[model samples]
Target: MLVKNISVVAAFVASVCIMPAQAQNNTIVVKANQLKADIQPTMWGVFFEDINMSADGGIYAELVKNRSFEFLKPLAGWTFKGKERKEGDLLILNRQDKQTNNPRFIQVNPNHTAKGDFGIINEGFRGMGIKQGLRYDFSMLYRQPAAGVKVHVELLNAKNEVIGKTTISPVATGKEWRKLEASLEATATEPKGTLAVWFEGSGQMDLDMISLFPGDTWKGRKGGMRADMVQMLADLKPGFLRFPGGCIVEGYDLSQRYQWKKTIGPIEERQLLINRWNFEFAHRPTPDYFQTFGLGFFEYFQLAEDIGAEPLPILNCGMACQFNTAEMVPLDQLDPYVQDALDLIEFANGDASTKWGKVRAQMGHPEPFNLKLLGIGNENWGPQYIDRLQVFTKAIKEKYPKMQLITSAGTDPDGERFDYLNGQLRKMNADIIDEHYYRRPEWFLQNAARYDNYDRNGSKVFAGEYAAQSDKTVSIHNKNNWRAALAEASFMTGLERNADVVVMASYAPLFAHVDGWQWTPDMIWIDNLHVVGTPNYYVQKMFSTNRGTHIVPILKNNAPLAGQDSLYASASVDKTTNELIIKLVNVSANGLQQEIKLDGVSKLSGNARHYVMKASGLDVENSLKEPLAIVPVEEQWKASGKSLKVNLAPHSVNVIRVKHLDLVSFKKAGKME
Candidate 1:
């Protein structure tokens, strides 16, 4: 049944429908002869930010928090276990002057005691997730004055019950630190778990880089990413992976900003920095949060390569976060920052003979990462950013002129800030301007024609970060609901329609942990062991997996079908597959019958494939227990002639792909049979 107040009928009909209301048909005519533009491969991607435990406890497989004893409290995530603490039994020793990179270590002097009588317990980020019958690998760096100390490790479930155990003995006692390793198998599955280390002998020893990782990691790399979580990203087949972060790129202040050079090399030597999100939200304070750099820049590039995506890294523009400090570096003192940007390109793509490139080679990747895109700022705006960007651009262009630079247009997509930056950047001939949007659902519908009036020859656009908000932006109550997802779908049609102007697009704040997230409405939500893609994730996957090579015109009554009668659509043709890809979005609460006509095709198969995603209501969502609550439901569709009729479900997003069998029309478009 159609909505009583709407007429998606004779007004937008194909071939002038003189028929009555009962005979009204939904028709979208695909102009096979009209090719608007070619779609770039980097049209859709995933934006990564190290928020909500996305690194330490979320994706990075390390289970031990404060592994290097580098947090503000040094032992914020660790607790003393067993008998009253003896004097000097555990001491956080700082050698800041000598070991600036990793200045902290724990010294333990245990009395003669049996195993399980004394030690420390590490409460993982939230709690370590353990699985039944899975092996837990533990390793640490240690130094002993004399060799008499032995260590016992235990894995505990959420109930604090021991489920796995192993022991290690250190014999190479000397001035130099030695590494020790052990493994244990868990006997039960638990979402919240802990790791306890017990001492068994009387000896003086020092420990650092204490860690534990599951045997089941991505590709079984000893110290790698979570397999289940990485698989979710691989499933989307994203075109690019934007790394290191949103606000992390621009720290709370310059001193706290993310420095990529400090993140690579031996894991222990990599200096740790406090994660900006640790103190951002007063409502959700996480004082223990910090960047271990275990998942550093090299790992990011490797992950992008593993999933067949281009690497796009963002660098700071010598300015701190505007909302936090708004601190700007002096123009004369910006050399180091500018040099950092220059060195990154060399690190990513320069030859091994180069300094930074040699460092990249030592980390195990000799071949260049083929870096093509670099963003200058996170959300900084005004003449200050422009001034800093100019210096970096002038230096980088002189050295690496071919590199494409992505400039910021501020936090909001449109405002005095955005307008000022947009005009200035365009005047300067910037390559790509990044635009972000986190607004209500109504805003999405209203701006569906945003890029329609953009200059066709100006700097290209990158919808760098955008998501339709169910509640106010940054509110704790915001949800990843169908209403927001559906609105995003309707707006995305405009992006696809303007593919010539928009080269790259991605949703922001990609992953969130259920127990630790400070922000809501993330694309994917994770618990200890399970991962669930929200309604928004499925919507992005549908558009990405079906994005064709070239855009084709899809019209209704000689006008672009955008928010007309509550309908939005875009069409494309895959030259390689010789198939027509059509996307239709129906935001109304009533089903509308659609008749799609292949205008130039004299003969074509009526059979097609329909991928439909619809939920019972806008507020319905997916949870860990019901991960597939809103996934795309695939159906085999068949009609009889040139027109195919599909019933667009109430508040649904649909994708239809049909093979063009007409040789004449196919050859006319330069596509073979």
Candidate 2:
């Protein structure tokens, strides 16, 4: 009865095919038996950077802002009350000559503060979101002259009512800085809380690296990430996590390049630096943006492990950002940068007894992170890039020969610079060449067959960063709309079809804050206490979650379905699940029906499911108020015999999953066609 009902439903589905003046309903025949290539688990991933408050106010669970006295405006987030202002009274001293790495510290004038209790209040990052009964860890570096100065810390709510308090008095009289720690247990929950530090009966207290962290962070680590934010990433089930940056690795200048060593070690000692995104976008300037490195390399590795993803950390390759300074380090001085790469490997994979491994062990993860692939540089161009790349390739091969390396194809996916680098890297037999593209939705739809003609013998491809720009490149008016995600999904069918050539792909600038973002069309958006997955996020999620082991061809009239009547499709058979997974996209403005005939399988279970993501229009988008606006809708699909019919909704992405009957049943019905 079920088979009969499925057959009737399939006939109805096929009969509904209609033709319009603009386009006709197409028939997509899936050759389930014709196997293509295997899909790599690392095909889908995430690219993260510290841009747009992505780390401090976005992910890292440190509630206090400007915890370190390193921002250009030293006390940008702090307000002082009952304070005397005079020359040398409140000073920011830099010990650059001695403590070269950490140069800034606050020096309060003792003579001027003797009259009253001086208080410093931090407004936090858009005000702290404190929960009732939660504990907050507070720590700071202090250089005291005597035991007379008592620092009282208090957490205050909107009404200026203190919910928690702690006191710290420096007992020693010396110039050397000492670390002090205290904990506060909030009596009531307050979404917006402020921290106040009052200096009473003071002499002189020099402070730097002041910080506060919530106790309930991911994995309960003292200075770890926000549980909710990390949970969202974990839920996506990404295969790999590309860390540190897109442009941050190559700084505005070589002097400001991301130095991994400076990022590790004690939080107090991890020197703060200005984030490149601080002023990169003049139209959307964020002057308060800075990198404290609290969520540094070690944390990145830990995050990758926590989310069950491979860590792909790209390093500085003797070149700064080409768009800016195009600074280069001499060949002789390049050894340090090269050595950093070698040490990074040891830190990630070497035994505990090793030097760098010991530092990693001290950071709470003694076990190796199972380092595999390493990217040399990010989006560098010209002969200058190749020259330095050759040096790194030779050195890394001589040492860790088995370690797989990824090389960049400049700032574009094509043109002179990209063509030259691709040729050179291919000649070098580079393990994988990274490619990037940020194009219009129409461009994505047109280039759905971009890799169809790629040389199979050349270096493999890693689509390192990409997103469909809805408006224009770097446009402030761009959006993460349905049209962009739909186009990306259509292009992804081609990437899956050529899985043998493209090994990894991920969306860039994985996160953005609604109020603090500099980049548009990001994958995920977050606020202080909430996060919303854009339409693009769900599109990536669907493909990643249902990734099949082997690709299968879904053709029409013996031709690959690439924009045939505005219909795009790709099919794959999962070896583990013994199911046929077909992906389809309808870019047309009208609904269409397709008849997919399974050639190799005689019988498929009538029970199947269809997952469809559709919207009313191309411009539809998800908002914080309605986060699920563009999410998928799932329902059981009816099918029978070797022919299955499906109706494609207008401007939608669909995945149909069906189980294949065993060999015994298939052989029994061999002649039944």
Candidate 3:
């Protein structure tokens, strides 16, 4: 049935009804020849933050928990047992002076002479997932004071039966730490398996950084990211990846900030720190949460390279998280923090002869990553941030003038703090300004034209971290539902329409473990064995994969079609493929029967394809049990001449791609035929 709202119909007729032959003004006219602006290649991207167990337990893929024995409770994830007794066998040793960052290591001391197999069993993050025939790499740092000390490693199933086993014998009786490595092939598949290490010797031994990794990691490198999670990101073909962010870049305190230098280098040597989200929320208190830096700066850059994305790494400014400690590094002692930014650029794009570049080469990636963009801070505000940012920009531009820096505009999209920072950034002539928004679905829907009047000549905008909140910001009840995703899609059409002003955008908190999450509504959610892409993920994928080169004017009647009869539209043409990609969003609860008229184009081929993502209900969500519940549905479409009637489903995002054929050339070819 046609929508009968008087205001809506009149608005549609006043804008869309161009030809008198058509009685109703229900057509969307797209000016194929009128190029509006050039679409940015990095307009759509993904933001990754370490909140919600995203790194350690979600995507980094290390199977051992508390690997460095650095958790507040050193043996939080491990259970000790002796062959005869279960008491006072395992001890945590700490060396405050030598290993300040990693001060603790587990030491196993049997009854001095009566030990069959006394060791500790580790319950991995929720439990390790083991598959038959797959190889698992196990490594640990060990030191023995006496000879004949052996460490027996085994992968055990849920039923307490061993599926894989390896042994590491420390023959040298010295205090020097020696690295032990072994690989175990599982004989059976188990989704919630555990790792057991038994020490059967007459001597005491110390171990630290007990680690296990799947051999089939992304790029097949040991101590690498999970293959499945990275593969999901790679499939999106994102133009850029914004990494190590949200609040993590600005730690709860200055000392806890995300230090790129500490995150790089060897995995074992990387300092372990308590994650800010460990006790942030009362609803989900994860005391075991910590940053092992296993998925550090190098891995983030590597992941970006593997996925064909430009690396946009955000560094910490002098000011810490404003909501927490709001600590600030003294201006006199801020050289080291600024130096980290300079060194990071070298590590990413410098030659092997450079100091930082040598570290990158030693890590096995000899080639530079060709870094172009760097973010100065996460969501910082106030004069302190501005002072620090001024120093950073002056120093960085002095060295690398061509490098683009993204400055922050506080947290809220439109407030006193945001206004102050935004104005200051513009006055400072910053290359790009990053803005974040975590608002309600209705707010997103209403703000579709937020940037329509932005100053195009000023610094470009980066919708750095944004996700439509279904319930409330940081609320446990907030969900990644179709409602939020649909609203975001609508808002994104506006962003694409003003592509010249909005250079880059990404969704926040990219990954979340279903059971270990501190934040809700992440793009992707995972469990012990399965990964699920939320409706928001598909929406982002649709916009990114189909993003064309240049924008074409798409109008309903004489006005831009933004929230007209609950419809939003944007069209762009790909110079490479000569294809017109038109995106449409129907926010209304009822279906839309709209005719799209192509103008100024002499001919358009009948060949077309429509990629759509719609959910049955607004509150519906995708889960590991039903991962495809809200995924894209592709269908072949045909257009006659320059007009096509499209039936857009309720609350849906559609990308329609049609071949733009040259009519004059086609006619000449037809005459020869």
Candidate 4:
């Protein structure tokens, strides 16, 4: 075949024969004139879960752990620093029969006690992240039965040296609990800092909901998300935000499943539940782990709005986690669960006059969230899930027909569970089917064409959660390395190529705390004072930011480049920006010279914006100390005669954007689309 007129790779040898492994075939042809499919707005997003201390001790900005003394071990995160006193001097009283939601409170009797003689220090979740000159706000529910009560607060570093100080005198003397708040500015910065409270000149005071937060929280909201953590999410410019999720939506038992109703309204009223991840590993016991619901449904919705992302909240169906309790509610008793789903839609998009919508307004969100997608379950399988889902589907559709429902394909991507659920959901004409995968890097590369032949008619696909496991699924040794990131980039090209079938996709297990993680290979890692976006995160950012308005075919030898010669490619044209955006993922460990032919092109900008990210080594990863070690490097490249001639670095994900002069001029002399 002669390429005198038709633009093709310079060295492109069209062959049906199978190329040897890692062969050097570096040819890619992007058909810019033809638009295949419209890329959905919610194509790439983020999946949030509360594992690895990502909630209570994480994104949730409450720095004080066990602030309400509600953990199983009532004083787990606290310590009595003063000399031991007689019985009844300090007591943990439970009002289980009265305040069922928050039944525990600490009572201190300091009759004739001098200042600094008795105090309790909170060893925040792995220590609080304190910044110099940043104000630390302290608040607690207190009741004083007598006069002469003063509370002293201090912030300490790792060496137990106080860097900040404040005092609170609860003058409200009565049996009823009253909320008291105060703020103190830190004089020094310490990533690992502690909060201490001294009971001084007190007759008797009962305290509950002892909380502290940094003044620099997101938007400076009193009790909002951590600024830096939320900034990482905002930086992604994500299409959607799936929240209050992962396994927490399907708890260890039905009795413990997340109840959205209980998570709304006042912070004091929000019921606290033991975190499902509490002490899962005997070797690394975290008995104090619990969900304070500080980051609940309202907060999740607000966060989505804050980050300019569509809210996709998954609710708890009538069944518990199949991997654990495998509990199910009788069909007759599933009414409440269905009602919860119906009410959530109202809470999100209902008018302010409606019941749940009023709750949204009362919570400072006067306008509706206008949520369009909702899921009933997360990773559940079997007929039990299907049955419960049937009820939920009927109810939600009847109430809000326009609302798109996401049905689960279960935990395994290709097991009997997935096949059965996938078949049933399609038969039911489900709007979207959620699929999850956590496999080796090779699996990702091999399955680069996963949705190539997926039916474009009925139920669309939602790659709800996926990660290329560096080791094995659920293995603590798995790392967020460059190899895994490259594989994911390769796989993602298929998702972009098949934009007609897969409407939504996201990377799973969004965050992990370096000191308190139970899961590895998270998109982002955080510690007391820092946030690190992994190489995988950079890949996501590169693709998402460059995601064009519509899909365009980028083929090699008239075939989609899916792992051939370890090169994967997808092309799109951004109608809004009048630019041709093409992504190339090179999996080889050695650099390769590549020629990209822009078929049916005439005139274009001389220089194109190029974003290239390459790992120094397969096993190398970004860390707290070196956050930008493997980040994308944005540069410019000059094109030659409407074609790009560039060298793709080994294990690199490259994005090239060429500005078109006009729709007509960018194509062949006689061609016009």
Candidate 2: tens digits of C-alpha lDDT, residues 1-673: 2232233223222333223356443556766665677788898889998887889887998888887777888888988766555576568888888876678888765553442357778888777777789899998888876777777888889887889888877776597888888998988888678998877774778888778888889989887898878987898888899988889999999988999999898887788889899889899998888888989999999999999899999999999999999999988789999999999999999888999999999988989999898989889988888899999999988989998898999888889898899999999999999999998786677777778778776799999989999888899888999988988998898888788788899988788988789988899998766789999999998888888887777887677766666667788778788888889987766687787787777676767889999998778899989899999999896667877788888788999999754322111111101
User: For all the candidates, what are their Cα RMSDs to the real structure?
Assistant: 4.2, 6.2, 5.2, 4.7
- Highest lDDT scorer: 1
Tell me the tens digit of each residue's lDDT in model 3 across 1-673. Answer: 1232333334322333212333447889877766677788789888898987889987898999999888888888998755565455678889889977788998876655433357788999989989899999998888887786777889999998999998877777488998989998999999899999887767778889899998888788878888889888988889899988878788889888889889888777789988989988888998899999999999999899899899999999888898999999898888988999999999999999999999999998999999999999888888888999999999999999999999999888998999999999999999999999899886676677778778878999999888999889989899999988988998899899888789999998899988799887799988877888899999999999999887777887587776766788888888788888999988776677889888767777767899989888888999877889999989997766878788898778999999854433211111000
The CA lDDT of each predicted structure is: 0.86, 0.83, 0.84, 0.86
lDDT of predicted model 4: 0.86
Off by over 4 Å in 1: 1-25, 660-673
Q: Which stretches of candidate 4 lie over 4 Å from their true place?
A: 1-26, 282-284, 665-673
lDDT of 4 by residue, 1-673 (tens): 2222111111111212223445555667877877788899899999998898998899999999999988888998888877667688889999988999899999988866677788889989899999999999999999987768789999999999989999877786689889989999999999889999998875889999999999999999999889999999999889999988889898889888999999999999898998888855665567778999999999999999999899999999988888888888899999999999989999998888999999999999999999999998999998888998999988888878899999999997897888899999999999999999899887777777888778878799999999999899878899999878988998899999988889999998899999998887899999988999999999999988888988878888778877666578899898888889989987765576888888767656667988999876778899988899999888986655767887887778999899853444333212111
* Worst 10 contiguous positions by lDDT, candidate 2: 664-673
TM-scores vs. true structure, each candidate: 0.95, 0.90, 0.93, 0.95
Could you give candidate 1's per-residue lDDT for residues 1-673 as a string of tens digits? 1231134322221212222446444677887645677889999888999998898889999999999888889888999988888788899999888899999999989989787777999999788889999998999999998888899999998778999998888885688898899899999998889999999899888999999999999999999999999998998889999988899989999999989888889888888898989999999888888899999998999899999898999998999999999998999999999999999999999889999999999989999999999989889999999999999889999999999999999999887999999999999999999999999887777677678778878999999999988888989999898888988998899899888888899998899999888887799999888999999999999999998988887877666767665688888888888788889988777777877877766667657889999998878889888888898988986644666778888888999888754534532332210
Candidate 2: what lDDT?
0.83
* Candidate numbers sorted by TM-score from highest down: 1, 4, 3, 2
Q: How many clashes (backbone atoms < 3 Å, residues ≥3 apart in a chain or on different chains) does model 2 have?
A: 0
The Cα error of candidate 2 at residue 237, in Å, is 1.2
The clash count of every prediction, one per candidate, is 1, 0, 3, 0
In candidate 1, the residue pairs with backbone N, CA or C atoms under 3 Å apart (3 or more residues apart, or in different chains) clash, namely 26-595
TM-score of candidate 2 on Cα atoms, chains taken together: 0.90
